[model samples]
Target: MHNSHIFDKTVLREYDIRGVINQTLNQNDAYVLGQLLGLIVLDKHGTKVCVGFDGRESSPFLCEKLSDGFTSVGIDVINIGCVPTPLLYFSSFFFNADAGVVVTGSHNPSKYNGFKISLNNKPFFGEDIKNLGIISKNYSYVKKSGNKIYKNISNEYIQRILKDFNGNKKLRVVWDPANGSGGKIISDLVKFLPGEHYVINSDIDGTFPNHHPDPTKNENLKQIIIEIQEKKADFGFAFDGDGDRLVVVDSNGNALLGDQLLLILAESVLEDHPGGTIIADVKSSQILFDKIQILGGIPIMYKTGHSNIKKKIHETGAVLAGEMSGHVFFADKYYGFDDAIYAATRFLSIFSSKTQNLTEIISRLPKVFNTPEIRFFCNDSEKFEVISNIRSRLISSEYKVNDIDGLRVTTPSGWWLLRASNTEPALVARCEADTLEHLNQMVSILSYELSLNNIKLPISF
Candidate 1:
């Protein structure tokens, strides 16, 4: 109980701790996390801690080991059993816990798993995450025994989400949890709704039997599209692996990216609270910002990642925030964390209470050409330096560059963005233009800049 355990340095990231489970992460790492995270809570004047885990195959083993570490350190632990990350966050408030931790891989492949920690009800990330590695590697925990108990908040969580479902219209819909942790939650949720509903892959399978459980990839959503079209459903929704992210499929089976969904959600949030500030990640389309402004809500673009957006919302008092990867946060009437299940319910409520022309509404937005986020290989150590060098080059050429998150250049054609991803060993770039030719040109500029750093842009993402 008094020996330090050094973790795989690569697992500690800016947003959350993640890595390929057995390869870079194992039971010892999980135990170290519990001890270190529990110490953080105690140091911050906290006592009780809530713990939850996803349906990943390795999640249960990690969860048990982590709980042992917490109890070994005299941190009272409340085990919520298998649940989505959002529900774990909710447990913090419902049980008045000092901190919360959830074992989830998010949208990564099944081989991946990690922990997301929340201290004092706020996200414990950035320097705090890195410090976990630093501190755990240096010293060990004191030997102390604590208590452990189990609590089930599933019924309460389901009912609380349904309380706000006072929609005017009832439309048939298809729900897909992608066989992740949210499967049971969705299965329970649809029964109480007014609309006729059909759910696919509702079994909580950590192996992700149906598709990879990632809705962002178009292929994973194809079956849901077919289900929606054949069932004559109004709209379809899908969740990422851990149920913290969501993707929407229109009636025509067209998938609307997160940027488009944020614009639509703005219509609902701004109608009730006009002139409120709304936040989106830097990679969002310019149209989204303009639309939010037009809707009478101020739009602020911050760095990508749910943790960053959550912190930005708390600091700026923004009513809503979302990322292109489908992590939507709502601070208006609920906790300001990325809860895909909650976001789906809110969107349904808005769909029924608000206008019915969902397709037409999105189509009416001003048309602009853009390329999907293009990710290219880059070393973790050099990606930031590459971006820095690229920024210097852009500045020397007098190009308008916004380096808020990474390097976003405003050009006559449109805006091109290049930023190092927080989660992976790669650089992400996006381009937007009024025309296809201009879009290509902007991408070419990004490519040329990367070439200068001896990095070649991938052919496509």
Candidate 2:
């Protein structure tokens, strides 16, 4: 029975089950996941589920099969139609559903698609997702039957944001949805907001003809920055393939890294909840930690992945949390799921009472030189081993090291990080310091350490 299906054990990843369509994942795979997840949800939460999908080419077919599988197992499926991942997360709480699933490829290539799941308002990830494979193989059941309800959740989601923020200040904001699922919602959202909005690539196109929907890469954001400059806008925002992550640009068209944006949002959130816990992934700069401390908020550095950070945030009851990859989660005034559109709205709200622009606020922060993420490819089997070897070497060294996610060594001038990429067969490294010279020195040390471990340095900048 298993061999007859297209589900590959390799495709069922740690965080979300993703793979190349037709080859590794097909209608049967989606149906199996739907059946397994539905049964799992019923066993754990005893309630219905909310299902949504992004503008991926494969999403519609997967959603249909998954819905069929859910109904086959006597589970109620609230189909929210095509929406961003965050909108589905919003429906989970807004409708009081048991769980939710977002069919999205995220920032991956167009050929891939996957599921990001939430159960009982918490992330269903890591081993939870992996164990679904076992459940699918072992569980014995006949397809009983259930029901699927179609609902339009956009208006309610829009109203929630509008109600939370009521600002009369007018500003010029440029939005680039990159033709993802967020494209459908951004127009309506900007319509209600007080802004002179210039939207580019806001039409839902799964092919993403203009550019890949990932905003993390500078190339993907070029058009948005150009539009921002051409229009002389106040600021700009870009959403990822699924619209869970956000990238921002200043009025001058300077791309704001996620760490910098996190600092800006953290300050605003900490105003209402003094000394509240704020979580940032280990990939964030040490400057962010120092600033958070200076702001009178507790800054805790945790593991990278969105699922890991969200779980830690729940455990610590943090008011806000974010990753350097632009996944910003707010527990202060909204659901904790990372929502680019929601974050963009909240960021604009920060300018309501101030004449200071985003660039000005960013300039006020202490400047620190940092390296963009550098990735070096490694075999999947060798990736963890390389990190483990590096960790062991750092343990006996004079440099202070943090092994939270992988290894972060602190020097007098700055810090350097080397971690295994969760989604790919690559080792991710970054360095930062008070000076460019110091940053270069840290990078050199990292290079020496990796060499000692016999790992080849592929690219250096």
Candidate 3:
């Protein structure tokens, strides 16, 4: 009663289905996934679905095959070709589609590609995604073919993103899309927004000619930093590959960490929606949580991953949520989905009435020495176990720990987090303290713990 087609295990990740082009993933796999998704939608009594793809060379072909499977399953496919993942998500909400999917690699390397999906206006991931693969292995199709329609929501989407523009300061700024999918929309976004805007690497080049699109990494933000300072702009915004995440660089070219960005945005968001819950991933600094409470808003620490944060935001009615990796979701005046372009606009709106610039706002926050998220190689099979053992031992050692997503240990110096990455086979850790010496002391503790577990320390850290 069912047909089974096995897919590469590695491609079905905790967040989304991703893999190297033509290796772990291929056109046939896309078709199978597309068909599986269509079947699931129909079973849920859904008819229409929105589909989009990024700028990768393989995207066009993948999108075509994926659509074919959907159409064959009698699911009306509204194809919004070549857009950022956020825009795809927006389409689901804007057009009120029952489901949606975007073929994208996100911030991964050029060779990588993946799909981000939404069902019934919420993130469809984790077990939902794995279940799709499982059903794919046993699915039997019915003879039905749905119609395909082409729609371009680019202009409408950009207008919606800028509709609530509260910016009046007309500050000078630089925006870098890193030659990723956000380029097209960013180019149009600046045109209508109130600002003296400048942009670099805004071409939708999948090869990522300038640098990898992940602004969290310093190397990716280098060119934008150089341009902003050289042009004497007020600030800079760098977008990740699919444009959902944003990295802000001050006028002096110092990029604000993700928590700092959220902290800054939270202050403003709380002004209108006071006492609103603000969610930050466990990797965020303690200062962010403390500051959120001081600002009269509830601070919730949750697991990492955009989908996880989005789900938590929906469940708790949070006004805002952000991760250390630059994913910021706002529910105040917009959908509770991460959008770098919208976040950028909101960040700039803060400048509308303020005399002080970007850096000045951050200058007031208490300073802490912290390490950027440091990841070490661990076999996928063992990474989760490693974190579990670390958590058990830490608790047995009488150390206070928060096990929301992973084991976050509290120390007199500061706090340290050890979590298995949901997206990769690695354990991610971050440490922070009032001073550099204390910070290293925390690192030493982390190293000692890893050594005790027989995991060799990564020399780079």
TM-score of each: 0.97, 0.97, 0.97
Better by lDDT, candidate 2 or 1? 1
Worst 10-residue lDDT window for candidate 1 reads 353-362
lDDT of 3 by residue, 384-445 (tens): 88888887788867567999988899887798889888877888888898899999888888
RMSD of each: 1.4, 1.7, 1.3
Reference-based TM-score, model 1: 0.97
Model 1 clash tally? Answer: 0
Name the TM-score of candidate 3. Answer: 0.97
**What is the C-alpha local distance difference test score of candidate 2?**
0.86
lDDT of each: 0.89, 0.86, 0.89
Q: Where does model 2 exceed 4 Å of error?
A: 1-6
